[model samples]
Structure formats: structure tokens, C-alpha cells
Target: MRFTSCCGGAGAKTLVLVGKAGNGKSATGNTIIGRRVFESKRSLAGVTSTCQLETATLSNGQIINVIDTPGLFDSSVEPRLLATEIAQCIKMAKDGIHGVLLVLSIGNRFSEEEASAFASLCQIFGHEIADYMIVVFAHGDLLEDNQCLEDFWGPNCPQLLTDIMAMCGKRAVVFDNMTKDEDKISRQRKELLSLVEAVVKNNGGKSYVNYLFEALNMSEMDLIDQTSEVTCSEKSHEGKKFHIKYEEQFEQLIKMVELRLGECIMRLEKQLAEERVARLEVELKAQAAQTKSKEEMIEMKERLERAEELSKKLEEKFKNAENQSKEKASETIWSRMGCIIM
Candidate 1:
């Protein structure tokens, strides 16, 4: 389905930046944004908890929001922290984010740490988020000593790079922030603009931001049918009947369709979990803040309110993931019994 916006003037674009910490993700944003909007540091968890939201005006006077996310691969932090950060970022950008710029540092072996990070991302955003994400290669200077991006990724960093492309569905580019090269930056900007244009065109000049969500519905239905088929096949085989398999598949499909309504509850839960973290972070920050200006105080207050809302929502999402995990686990058991195929 295409998204069409009938609004006129001042189109807004939100780009969320993500990566394992210290991959020059913030620097890339600073370069494109032409300022130090995001605080860049050498530490692993520099961005830490997704609080920084910067909005920059492009040459065309269009508003571009740069959301810098925390490093998901820091061993010092719990995995749930990353999930919480992502949840907060999305929640804060309810105005509709345009794209997710997934950055990777050049020359590093895209490790399992990265894979796990990607998996959590997939689980958080699900399959459909791929529609709004583009690969952003940071620190490309490391590749200067080697061959091109393709050769370097193809030889040493094949698997992770391949997995990233698969997650992004093959939309990506390399950005060398260290170079004083206009051509390189221009090329990267062009790719970013192209992604924006494509999104605008495909979504009918409106941002579908969550349209990748369409795939999730299909995936769930597929899971349900898969479960039902397994059950029917096992029972039918014992009863010496094959016709029941199709009937079982049909019934399961219907049940899955009916269960789609329950997804609403799951979504609410996910929001609750996110809110909890956001609230805690805000409260902690508020308590620490000594002398705040009027604007800072208002922002903190708003953050507190958002946290309350998210806490309830995150609780719900956690419950949803739990339920989904159980459903998949049940299907797995059936699969082992030769009941569910696919």
C-alpha cells in the first residue's frame, strides 16, 4: 500500500542513526548536519540511551531530524538497554521518522556482536522496518589501504555485510568522514537523497515510516498456517487421511486472521516497556540536573510525561514478545514432531 500526504509546504524528514558505539556514527551526522549536534566521544556507549534529538535545516530549508542511537554492542550494558533506547527513540519521534541510517565502521570484522545487535533490531522493528533503513558505512578511511567497499566486504567481512544488506534489502552506501573530499560526501548525500525521494515517491509524497509493518502481518499469518499445517499433518497421518491437512491449513489461516486483533494488545505492551525505561531515564536525569533554564525544565517535564506513557506501553510489548516466543516455541516442538513444516 502507498502512503499519500496531502499536506503542502515544509515537508519534514527524520533520519535515525544507529550502530555499535564509536563507529563515527555521530561524526557522520555532524558532518552532514554541518555542526556538532550530537556529542561524539571515544567511549563505547557514547550516545547512551537515545536522549539526543537534533534537527537541522538543509540547504533547501527542509527540516531533517537526526536521531542518534546508543551503541547496541557494548558488553558493559544489558541487551534490554539497547531495546529500551530504540523504543524511546521511536516513541519520541512519533511525528514520523523517515529513515534509519544504519552505520558500520570500515575495516572491522562485522562480528557476531553486530549480528546479535541486528537481530535485536529486527525483533524490535520486525521485518518491515527494512523499508525505511539504508546502510551507512562510516570511517571508510580504513578501507583506503585496501580495495573498494565491495572487495573489502566481499572478502573479509562478507557474512555480516551480506546479512546487513539482506536486512536492508540491498540499500546502502559508504561514507568516509575523514576525507576532505566533496565528491565522496556528495555521493553519500545523493544516495541519502535518493532514498528520501524514493520513499516520498513510493509513499506518495507522505512518509509511510511504519509501512514495513505490512510484512509483519504476512509473517504472522505464515507462522499460523505453518503451525496449523504441522498439527493437521500429524493427526491426518495417524488417521490415514490427507484431506484433513488442507482443511487444517484453512482453519489455521482463519484463526490467525482472527488473532490479528490481539496484535493490538501486543503493540500496546511493547510501548509500555519502552515507556518504563524512558521514564526512568528522565527521572534520573531530572534528579541530577541542578540549574536548568526554562526550556530545559520544560523538556525534562515532557520527558517525564513521555516516560509514564511509555512505561505502560513497554510492559505490553514485553508481554507480546513473550507470547510470540511461546507461540514460535510451540511451533518448533511441532516441527520436531513432523507436524509443522516451514
Candidate 2:
């Protein structure tokens, strides 16, 4: 891939623009640089197929380096190509990245692809990327005069968008790329730069550099050295030689990413299964306890009925014995009276 760098000096804050197709990432980059450095147009497929870097001085004379990247989740592009482009983007920002702009079109409905954008980025770049991320909503002109950026975050707002914003520390800004008013453009640029500055400050005045890339750079150098040794040793065929391109290295990186993603998915599935099993066990235990309670209640009722029947029988027998005793006493009294009379 062709890499371009121009007009960048020391302490230039580097910002990378990433998003899906037709989300105005290029336009956002252009807006940030206060110029049309990156191409911006409407397309069904995509305009940017690789990474491009351009630098511009802000109104305050602060040099800003903007890297415009191809669509991170463009369906039309192959996985290998996307991986290579992303690798190029990382290489361009290998020194350090001040902030990452996650551009989204405010007018477009947030779809599943867009919803998973941040998670996908995390899967590739690690979760720490969130610390340096700022969500930039493009096409702010679509908002009504009375509506603000918060208006889009009503009850009906997408939960994924809310999650992404929270993940990025709730740092976000809306840009009207179509706006030609110099005051509005300058204000938007200032707001974005302010967010970027905040990101730098929150990170202890340091830019983000992935350790994985550092490891990859070391591995690449080692590979190149090994290849050189082998080529020098091979005197049989000088014409047929082995060479390693960055594309190949990136392909390997992509494979590693795929493998890691697979492992995460498997682990998640296992956790979900375990949770289901635990929930089912709880339900079964509750049902068993309820059944035992009902059985104990029934036994207690039967025992009470039996005790009542026995008490009734005993009371009847006592009444009969009393009546017999009374009758026998009355007869004896009458006989004695008759004897006295005779």
C-alpha cells in the first residue's frame, strides 16, 4: 500500500478517522484539517480503499495530522484487504496517535453493522482504544434549528450508540460538513480539537501506541533478517528468491486476530451456557422446595382429621357409660322403697 505524509512537524497531534462506508469519515477528516485534503463523496461501495495522511496548521498555528482510513466494515471489501489497510493505518500512526474519531452519519439509521463497529474495533485494537476514541456524528445540518445533539439521544435512541459514547468517556461532537459558514466551521473545528486535547490530557499527555504493533515491528525486522541470511546462503538459484511483503505480514496478523476473536466467542458461549445451567438449577430447587411444602401441609391436615375422629369416639363412649350408671342407681332405689312398705 502507498503511504503519504506531508507538512507534519514536532508535537503534531495525530488523529485517525474510522467508520463504515458512507459515514463521512473522509469529510470529517477534511473538516478537521480545515481543507479538502481527503476526498469526500457519496458512493455505494466506497471511496477510500487505503490509508492517507495529511497535515494542516490550525488557526492557532497548532499542526494537526489527520489520517483518513478506508471503511473499516465495508462489506464489499475483502477481509484480507481490510486487514492490510488497517495495518497501513497503524503504520502511519506508528509514532503515536492522539485520538481516534469514530465518524457516524446522523441522518442514517444505525444498523447492526454500525452497532458492532466499536466492538469490532476493540476486537482488533484491544479495549484500550476506547480511552482515545471520540465519537463524531457527521451531517449535523440534518438537525432541526431547535434540535441539538442530545436530541438524537432520546428514549428511542440506539442502545449501542449510547454504549459507545459511554465507553469513550461520553466525549462526542457533531459536524456539519455541508456548512460553508466560516464561523460555524471554525467553532466545530475548535470543539473537536478541544476533545482531542482532553483525550491527550486524560492519557497523561501521551499519545496511544499499541504494544501489539511494537511486537509486530520487532517480528518483521527479525523475519527480514532471517530471509536475508537464507537468500545469501542459497547459491543454487539467484533468480528465484524469497521475499516477504508487508501484505503477507498483515495477513498473518489478521489470522491472529481471527483466532483471538474465535477464542473470545467460544469463551463467551461457554459463560452463557454456564449461566443458563445455574439459572435452571435455581428454578428446579425452588420447585422442589414448593413441592415439599405442599406435601408437609397435606400430612398435617390428615393428622388433624384423625385426631378429631378419635376425640369424637371417646366422647360418645363416655356419654353411654354415664347413662347406664344412672339407670342402675334408679332401679336399686325403687326396690328398697318397696321392701320398706311390705
Candidate 3:
């Protein structure tokens, strides 16, 4: 993979762009890779027709494998099948896919489809994939009606967006695909680089930091809610504020590291689980075939034993007939002799 901005990280970072259909995931992929690697065209119905692997190399030498998939939540399609396709992509890109960009249209509200996609991510990559994910809002300029994207997704928006950001570690950026913006892309790439570096520094950095931050965030919340008024003073309050900020910044670095590590581990575990499941399925089929073969062999053995018993009975009857004929001939010979003597 070409990385123009070198962080000298340990491994290649695979950035996956995922979203609902017609959300411009393919286009954003083309923009980042600096070419139209994926097939993008408008059709009568809202759908991205490219369901194959499309890859390109960036100027930075990063190998960008952009998987153009069918719409995640098409009303006409089966949900389980769509989920399977997503799973296939995940397996294919399991080697180095480091970042996940959950592309969202700035103008459109987050829908149940988007929520379903989010759930799929959690299901496929575990709840931790959200940590390495960036909520990339496409068509940022459309949010001009809302005055600001931040304000619109601010303190009073629906819980879905809040849940998304919270699950995604509140790490998000808006990208105007119409304006052909590159700023957010660059920022995203840099953040990815930092994450890679941190992952190299400590293999468990991502998961560890996330756990640490969750603890700290909980503690911060507790400090505000659980403390008695008499126990806290004005000076102590300011000191606590400064301490929280400092601790947060310190923990932020740790969290970023942990997030990357968590991503790496999650990818490995997912791949292993997939492999294990496939292997077990194959073994089961083979065992069934073997069992059938064993049953056929037992039936053949029984048939052979019955044929042998019938053969023995026929030989005994033939012997008895031959002996009777000999005895009768002897009696006839004796009678003829007696007649000749008389």
C-alpha cells in the first residue's frame, strides 16, 4: 500500500468505505484512490450495480482495494443475502483493512437501513470495529440548510446519530463529494496513519485504550453526578476539571492506539471464526458421506452371508440325489444276478 505520509507503521492499513446504497461510497472511493476504480452510474432505481472487487493504487503507494457492493438495505433484496455479501467482503479484505468509513449523506437523515448496516458491522467485526470507524458524512454542503453539520448533529439530534458517534468513539468528519473535497480525506488518512503507528508501538493499544477511556468517561460522569456538594470545593472543582482534561488527552492517545490494536485483533478473530465455521461444515459433510458408505458396506456383508448359506444348501441336496441314484443301481444289479442264478 502506498502511504505518502509516512508514520513508519508496522503493517499496511486497509480503509473500507461502507454505507447504504446510493450513498456515494464508490465515488468517494474513486476520489480517494484518485481515479474511478469502481463503476458509478445513475440508474432508474437507487442501486450501485458493481458487486465485484475493484482495486487501485494511490499516488502514496497504498494498495486500495475498493469493494463495490450491492446496496446494504434494498427493500427488494433479502437482508440475510446482503449481509452475506458484506461478510464475503470482510473476509476478502481481512488481510489489511484497518479503517472503516461509514459514509452517510449529509442531506439525508440516518435511516433504519443505516442502523442495520451499523448492526452488521458490529455483528461481523464485533462492537470494536466501531472504534476504527469514521462517520464520513457525504455531500457536506447540503447541510447549509442546517447552518452547520456540527450544529445539526449537535446536542439535540436524534439518538441514532448520537449512538453512532458514541459507538464510533465520536470520531467523524464531513466530506462534500459534490464539491470534490480532499481535506477530510487527508485528515482521515492521517488519523489512520497515527493509528497504525500506535498499533505498532503496542499491539493491544487500540482495545486497551478504548477500555481505559470508557472507564475514564464513566468516572468523569460519576464525578459530576455522584459527588456530595460538601465534599467538593471551588478550587478542587477547577483542579478536577484540569485533571480531567489532561487525563482525557493522555487517554485519547492511548485510546487511539488501543483502537487500532483492537481492529487488528478483531479482524484476525473474525477471519479465524469464519475459517473455523467453514472447516467444521466441510467436516460435517464428509462425516455424513462416510456414515453412508459404512451403512452400504454393512448391507453388502449381510447379502454375501445369505448367498453363502444358499450355496451350501444346494450342494447338500445335489450330494443326496447322487447317493440315491448309486444305491438304486446297486439294488437293480443284485436283483438281475438272483434272476440269472435261478
Clashes of each: 21, 0, 13
Score each candidate by Cα lDDT. 0.64, 0.78, 0.60
**Better candidate number, 2 or 3, judged by lDDT:** 2
Q: Rank the candidates by TM-score, best first.
A: 2, 1, 3
| C-alpha-based local distance difference test score of model 3 | 0.60
User: To one decimal, what is the Cα RMSD in angstroms of model 2 from the true structure?
Assistant: 9.1
Error of 1 at 53 (Å): 0.9
Any runs in candidate 2 off by more than 4 Å, and if so which? 1-10, 217-342
Error of 1 at 12 (Å): 1.2
Question: Model 1: per-residue lDDT, tens digit, 264-323?
Answer: 335545766787999999987886674456678899999999998999799999999999
Clashing pairs in 2: none
- Estimate candidate 1's alpha-carbon lDDT, on a 0 to 1 scale: 0.64
| lDDT at position 328, candidate 1 | 100
Q: Judged by TM-score relative to the true structure, which candidate is superior, 2 or 3?
A: 2
lDDT, model 2, position 297: 94
Q: Name the better of 1 and 2 by TM-score.
A: 2
Where does candidate 3 have its weakest 10-residue lDDT segment? 1-10
lDDT of 3 by residue, 124-232 (tens): 4557566567677776666665366667667767687788878876766665555544766676445544553443344342221223334434555655554444354
